[model samples]
Target: MSTATATPEGALPHRDLSHTPWRVLVLGATSGIAEATARIWAREGANIFLVARNADRINAVAADLRVRGAAYVETAVADLDDIDGHTALLGRAITALGGLDVAYLAVGILGEQPRAEQDTTHALHILHTNLTAPVSLLTWLSNYCVNQGFGTLAVLSSVAGERGRKSNYVYGASKAGLTAFLGGLRNRVDREGVHVLTIKPGPVRTSMTTGMKGSEKFADPDKVAREIARAIDKKQDVLYTPFQWRPIMAVIRAIPERIFKKLNL
Candidate 1:
């Protein structure tokens, strides 16, 4: 058990468990980035609550974490798109863990841009999954952490959100909304002693982008995970996972709309 402190939200008091080990809840536990992060945190002796919709994959990952020296490993199943399921899933994980010290919101879908534009259903699903779901989950989680008085909430935004490109603007748009939401969320919670880290990763070679080409600049999931862990320790406000992407995206974001539209990015 850790020492508890009162927070502004008055939900659940937080504790300084840093001297002990950490307990982390990872949404999208099956994601390459999330899985890698879990491994890194577990290696440092954190208890892990891995949440994902796939039971087989989650269990396998949990087992791996235990073998790798995690203090404890637990699993929860939920599809991010299912509102009720996501709520129940998170509630159960938090209860099982006793408390949450860190949360990584790492679920997203990258639908085909053309398909999303052509189909309302596709666009809606993408928007809901990427933007709305995360916003809702973070709102709940942040409140919980704020009341607890100390915790870090890391949200995975993207460079695409900085400026939409013709190549994948629909997906980019969804991320854009998420980025904005997280910005406001950070502002609202920081005063309460809760840290929010907005991570904008440019490219990653994950199963999600398996067929994508020209990804030489992509960061590895393991590297990204390590960076995230370091950022959390430092209480960073926002981070470009690779560090290099900050300036790269800055230039991209500064491009004039007319000229940017003419160029094939």
Candidate 2:
């Protein structure tokens, strides 16, 4: 039987896949959250399509998943900043998996605010990587999944998107655009048997925040992965990774703009 035709035991929402294996395509496979999520899904018996820019890192992650009992694992290298490559990358991932059941767009960059302020190029790069690329990829994936008549498109947004703050407004703005985009995508695909989940994580301890100082209420990558898996299984529309961020962001959103501007968050 073809690799895609071989069904992995214990795949979620179990279905007869005589032509394809139950597969997940993770865009930022080397990222902490994506890596954690990949491990969790591997444990659950799902084939993984690990996509990242770094070949070595992606291969290492794929190997790690194999060691962790992943039924099947594949890696693809693509720089998300290459706008022309988005659709092709998604298509390649789908083909690699023989099909796709879940597509996680977890690729993002958290650039330094001070650097962004000084360099327009850097700012635009961050915006494109964080917002534009995901939007374009999801648009393609959404149409593809809808045409296939099933699948889930999961996006990792941020609590920072809830409201713009002085510290990371550019980053937050990009996430804000993503959050809004996913909201519309969710509404559009709900009746089509396609699931769209927008994950808003307040603070996560990942390489993205490496060297950042001080203790804060941060969610571990593993914890965030667990929440993501649960949200996918439950077909949840929106999720706050740690759950507490929902109320916290609500309050942050409610803060008077004048007052909010006065104090650094």
Candidate 3:
């Protein structure tokens, strides 16, 4: 599969997108939340570049976006965990889209916690995919946006990161590290005119949570996507989707570690 797509000749390098379609790059284009958010952007006639490891699925997403009224749609197949290829992939995305207005990162894994507890390799794999890979992508993206003095970096983190629960502490650790990285990235780039939005979602319904207990009770991914789109438009620094996770996580964070460790989460 081709790692990148072609851009039209004479595509504008960069411009104020307020009057034109927003150019967007979605890292985990096949993820439920990212795809849903892209659909909203498509309805606004955005130019979009989708990057994901799955060719068939990403192509379907691109076709859907095109039919939904995206001004331009392109897809590149890539395994985001392969950090060495990120620079090249990101370069291709920018070249294809002409410029990037928003980059949404939704790549992550909810690994088996039981296996992670007993196996160092499994735990490290989760950390690498969820934490290390995103950090690498954001590092490059932040520098690019800083140089341009414009762009939005919206990342999908989880409220589970607020406090470590015995059930999924490994996954939570990955998100916690990501949340910290975004916070620091925002502190560095906001003054340079770059917006870094840290999205903390509380168990939304998606492929990752398909078989989990109480999946029906999970927040709708579409609703979460709408909130995310609004947050980016407003240049909000942090968002807790469903509007309840903010206070929920706040209470969770405020619980004393002494008492928190004793209760089942």
Could you tell me every candidate's TM-score relative to the true structure?
0.92, 0.91, 0.94
Q: Each model's C-alpha lDDT?
A: 0.83, 0.83, 0.90
Q: Quote the positional error of residue 237 for candidate 3 in Å.
A: 0.5
**Cα-based RMSD of the predictions, in order?**
4.5, 5.6, 3.7
Positional deviation of residue 133's Cα in model 2 after best superposition, in angstroms:
0.6
The residue-by-residue lDDT of candidate 1 on 137-247, one tens digit each, is 887788777777778999888888988777888899999999899889889999988899999887987888776786655678889888988998889999897899999
lDDT of 1 at 167: 84
For model 3 the local lDDT of residue 36 reads 98
Model 3 misses residue 225 by how many Å?
0.5
Best by lDDT: 3
On the 0 to 100 scale, the lDDT of residue 234 in model 2 is: 85
Per-residue CA lDDT of candidate 3, range 38-148, in tens? 999999999999999999999999999999999999999999989888878898898888778899999999999999999999999999999999988888888788777
Worst 10 residues of 1 by lDDT: 1-10
Which candidate do you rate higher for TM-score, 1 or 2?
A: 1
lDDT of 2 by residue, 96-166 (tens): 77777889989999998889989999889889999988877888888777766678898999998888877
What TM-score does model 2 achieve against the real structure? 0.91
